[model samples]
Target chain A: MEQELISKKELLELTKISYGQLYRWKRKNLIPEEWFIRKSTYTGQETFFPKERILDRIEKIKNMKGDVSLDELANMLSPNLTELVRKREDLIKLNIISKSTLEFYTEERGKDKELNFEKILYLSILDNLFDSGKINFDEGKLILTFLDEYYPKFKGKNCELLFLRKLGISSCCLVSKPNEINFENSMKVVEKLNISDLIEELKIKLV
Target chain B: MEKNMMNLEIKGSGSSEGGKYNTVVIKGNGKIDGNLDCNYLEVQGHCEVNGNVKSESVKVNGNNSIKGDLEADEIEIHGEVNVDGNLSVEKIHTHGMISVNGNCNAESFTMEGAFKIRGLLNAGELELKLHGPSEAREIGGEKIMVKRNGRVKFTRIRKLIMPFGFDTGLTTDIIEGDEIYLEYTNAKVVRGNDIELGSGCNIKLIEYQNEFKQHEEAEVVTYKKIRKT
Candidate 1:
């Protein structure tokens, strides 16, 4: 079978990469060497890279670099900067906490002389439930009362209940008899919480 | 005997030398070194034709085997008919079944039962009502249609490269051993035991890596508009 040959100029044009950058990546062993197939002409030898391999390398580079260069940002904000940005994006997308809600939660917690983890967890759960359209304030309080009566023993252990209380949303009653309440309302309460953040944290801790 | 009703029953040779018949019916078992050329040819018992067959319509009731090619307007086989050469006909209807090791070109084909073919099938409209239990080495055509209620198994697809995509067809379930490369086509539903889509393959539905099924691994990518249909 006849082999289909392509020129280096064509590869560069297709990939939209500078010669210098291509060579630099090639030296770093980021792109496969076999992609640059060499052919001997009458005058001399020429090198050509496969279009697919070049494109794959470009995608890898994009993933490593975030929105802004690290050197461009201030030195103080450099620590855990990527993580903070990622978490913020995730929280916004998941609808766990709005910008205003986060400010409110922070202010309320800061004012408390003794930090009650249970109350904080309850507040977070309530915020998530409301945000997820799981429950309104009135329904949330009723559910919290049900939880207080039925599963009073479970009040302190499950931080989710505390997160709800901390968010100033009804927390206890709903957790105790979660099934008795409307499923949509229950989902709303859970959705309002930053479950994605919790899940990410769990994954980091466990895995 | 007249040329139209020349039912020549040759005990030694199956060839029709002196008679010119419109309808040639072979009664007993015989062998023909040369071809059989007539309007309508019917084989009641077992018969073998060494040379090519040129007729308007050919029907084999009993076991018939042809070494040379069969060229006719319409062909129907009720019993097992093995053709070593190519078969070219306007329309082919098989009831018992057919096993051909060569290619086939027909306008419209209907197979009531199973069939096993080694070479390509080039037809305008083809329908297989029964199951396809046998394996085919290679198959290529423009508008290939198949309706199989039973299991259709292919050991290997050396190259199932459909550049034009599937014009129109449906495989209820397909179990293949090799890869399937499809591009630029649409299908109602394709459920395979294991399926792999080559690069630049555009398909509609792909259910892959299913834990609950027997034929598990499935991968579909580099396509537009894919659902779990």
Candidate 2:
């Protein structure tokens, strides 16, 4: 979990974003309902947010809102399109999942295997990371296994895939609760990305 | 055949509930429910809102309580305001007391009164000559200025009933911006491009890109000026 909690007052002062915008975003579903985070303070009940996440989200919203409408922004933040199934050709046409990864996926899971949206997202993420020179092909396979095993467990939460490489060995972990994207002492972070942001990026590219 | 209603007035204990209008004026103790989207809103007597208030301009003279968020181009508060949600405006000139449970965002915030905000206070130009103690958890902007009136005294009697119980000094955590000017403030970290700290500021860290100047009386524990990357 992101541990640092910032009071709503502090958030507003720091961002200078008004309460109306925050609540409007809440109403529009641009921010996760769980992030509202009500806590008891000396002065009755006050709202708090996971500082890092909210700050990143608000910055994203501010930057993207000028280009898109509020409803579209809400759609971008909305999650759980994981079960939507797409054909292999459609996924390639959508320019999300690469052909090489799709070939590899079909080879392992069988050509006729019906992959859901989450599996496709994982494959797309792996393909993109490898193509961008962030992760090796073998490390990508580890990330795929990690995602296939653990990504589905997180229903509505935003999770990230982290590939840690150390001493000529690499391992991947799914972080449902991320803190600082730690690389430890000597571990190299191969590639890390929040799944929802990947989905949004794909959506933007599709649009 | 038609009424050119450019303004609206509620007088003599009259009350109305929610609608859209061009301009709204409440002279008597009035109440409104639902969304109030108008061009201008002025409250001279006690007024209460049960929903959001959006207008081009808002001027509050008497006590007003908003159950929902408030948004406007310009909001001038000379009396008292109690808001249960966020407050977004272009320019806010507050001379009395205002309490917002949510964030306060504006292009420019000019305050000479007691203000309590539960959320961030972000703006372009934040100028304040605080009448009483005011507080926000985080304060950031392009050009930030906060100075406590020299004549004001931090008496024990005044500290007893203040809204947030903030002492006469302004207290905050991280204050980062491009140009920051502070006086009589206590902050954990102050980072900016051009920072000039006035007297009586207690800042733990001052990370600047270009210039950093502190008054002789201001106390800054750590400060660094780094080259722009």
Candidate 3:
């Protein structure tokens, strides 16, 4: 049996991928490098790729789709995936827990608590999220969910509750109450809460 | 004569009487002191005109020179031309070298070879080719193009010059609503919203004055170390 040569257009159509994706895969070494053949023409010499190698590589990528990301797939077949997924997952989990914990502790501490354990936990979660690339400011509200389940007595404090709500945290109060509050008023509440101090504390603990 | 097919030829040293014609092809060396209003005029030999050359289209092939101003819908010069006065045309294509002492205002202008201008060069669409190596002290136009091995020089005075802004420097500068390509022979300082620098250009300085900073990554190659004087 003889192998057939395929054009880049044909290969892309068969693989159901864009030209950019195909080129990116080629760059990462996920696909087999193509062989170029020169053909002489009236104007100049044109170069073309061999079709067999491209088809074979496309088949391999189709088989590896479920097991790896495109970047990982690039290395697993030829070069090196470098264990990026495991490291990334670990970092993400660490950040989520650290930020959530800090928000929990801040709400738990009152006006004169010597040690704010809740703030510390929240900061730690933020640090973990930062490391994991999941450090969304909205995730700071997740602490309230954990607190509502854990501590029921801290609910009626408008300052602390509104502060969390303003930070885009999901809260039972926000869902129940519908009011048109401007950013200026929300910022005033934020200022009164002195979240900057908490943020400073977070920076010291997390960094 | 048919309105669509009107051919008027002047032989020997004769004068072209001012009249609107379809096609006027001057084969020999002739002179026209008055305005020439025609659809198309082709001059093969040397032609010295004293007045404005007005036509729908004009083509000068031989060593032709115009001492007076020119007004036409379209003008093409295939040979060397020395215009001592201003030239106003809709479209112009000069295959040979062109030297203009005064201003050149046109909608579209193209020079295949070298182009030299002593005064201001203004056009809605201007394309120039500095074939070997040329220089211009002060030049201004709407759209400009300098092929490979072309040089442009502009003297900087006390003035705020802005290139293009927001939009990429792909299109020419617009006045009210018109695309004009402004090409320089050597240097250019623009103060506009959008500006684009074509490839294969060696520029001294490019300054941008805007609130937002747009970063573009490009290959930087340092050739020599300089000392402040």
Candidate 4:
């Protein structure tokens, strides 16, 4: 899907933020570097941003400002995983994932009792998929295996989880920061989830 | 503890491998071969580092060069320094010259000599007293103030070097700040909230929010007031 873009001038006007504030946030790493797109126009070269994402981020920053320092805010907003170990029972009690999801994860992965940040993140993704009624248990196992094998290769980079069904043969793959992907007419894209967004959500839940 | 770490000192022309140190003092020509993490780095003579430098404080009295990025809490330069990568420091007090091939980020940057930054110079409070020609691709900060040092030494030196006059002002592509005051600067676009264009400023456009002032000799082509939402 093509992302809707908003010009820098329009973004500043809409958000009621000054140039200094925008640049300060950028320098503070509150804004990612890839989102600042430069394109040419009749007047000159101008900057653009993904419309919905920028608006949502600005709103979040404004709402969360003054309660925490900018560095803390940057840490919260970033997509990096925290070095934390969470108990399975406590996670269930926190309502981040259900007990059945944990059981399924253990059956496929291992019988390990300790749940690190990575395992919890995978479990949370499975829980989200199960809650949305998108994939079956077998498909969930495939996802877990795929993540266990290839997820580490990305090394904390932005990626996507693609679930495609070609003639009822459900297969999943991962792509890093995919801009565009084309599928044949017979292929069906069941569920496409951005892993960075999932990481952000999981981070909030863990907090 | 840092107190127990060994200090690396090169008294004459020598080379040392980089590592954790209490203090690194180079009195003559010295070369560091790897990343250096230290409490204090002082160079009274010439020094070169082939990797990144992470230090609490850095004091350079002679020529120094770093091949990688430099991260310091405080940096004071009385001579010349060059970095092939980015620079991130809390405070910088320079009276000589410093050049960076990448971006420069600081909390408070006060310069009285000259600088050439190929990338952005982002700071919280930036005060540049242009003793010589300075250049940056872009400058963005909270409060930016640039002024010319109207001393006779520079004029006398320029007269001795060349018969024709030269522009010792700052040259930048874009400058954006909340409070900005420019003197002897040539920029394409300047956007700020409260802006004052001093004499010898040649800007293509000026966009201000609250107030705007221009000196009589400043050559500004266009000015516009932006409404603050």
Q: Which ten residues in a row have the lowest lDDT in candidate 3 chain B?
A: B168-177
Higher-ranked by DockQ: 2 or 4: 4
Q: What is every candidate's alpha-carbon RMSD to the true fold?
A: 27.9, 11.4, 27.1, 2.7
Q: What residue pairs clash in candidate 4, if any at all?
A: none
Q: Show what share of the native A-B interface contacts model 4 retains.
A: 0.45
**Cα RMSD, model 4:** 2.7
How many times do residue backbones clash in model 2? 13
State which candidate has the highest TM-score.
Answer: 4
Per-model C-alpha lDDT, please?
0.48, 0.77, 0.48, 0.88
Chain B TM-score per candidate, please: 0.59, 0.87, 0.63, 0.95
Stretches off by above 4 angstroms in model 1 are A1-207, B1-20, B138-143, B149-229
Tens digits of per-residue lDDT, candidate 1, B1-229, equal: 2353555554433554322457767767767777767787888877887777777888888877888788889988888788889877878999876877786666667776666666545454455554434333323222233443333353123126544432222222121111223322232223222343322223344433221111122233322222222
Return model 3's CA RMSD, one decimal. Answer: 27.1
lDDT tens digits, residue span B22-67, model 3? 7777778787766656677788987777766666778888876777
* Model 3 CA deviation exceeding 4 Å by range: A1-207, B1-8, B12-23, B135-137, B149-185, B188-205, B208-229
- For candidate 1, write residues A160-202 as lDDT tens digits: 2322333454443323211133444333333322222343332
Clash totals for all candidate models: 35, 13, 43, 0
lDDT of 2: 0.77
1 against 4, candidate with superior lDDT: 4
Point out the higher-scoring one by TM-score: 1 or 2.
2
Question: Candidate 2's error at B122, in angstroms?
Answer: 1.5
Model 3 lDDT, full chain set: 0.48
Q: Lowest-lDDT window of 10 residues in candidate 4 chain A?
A: A38-47
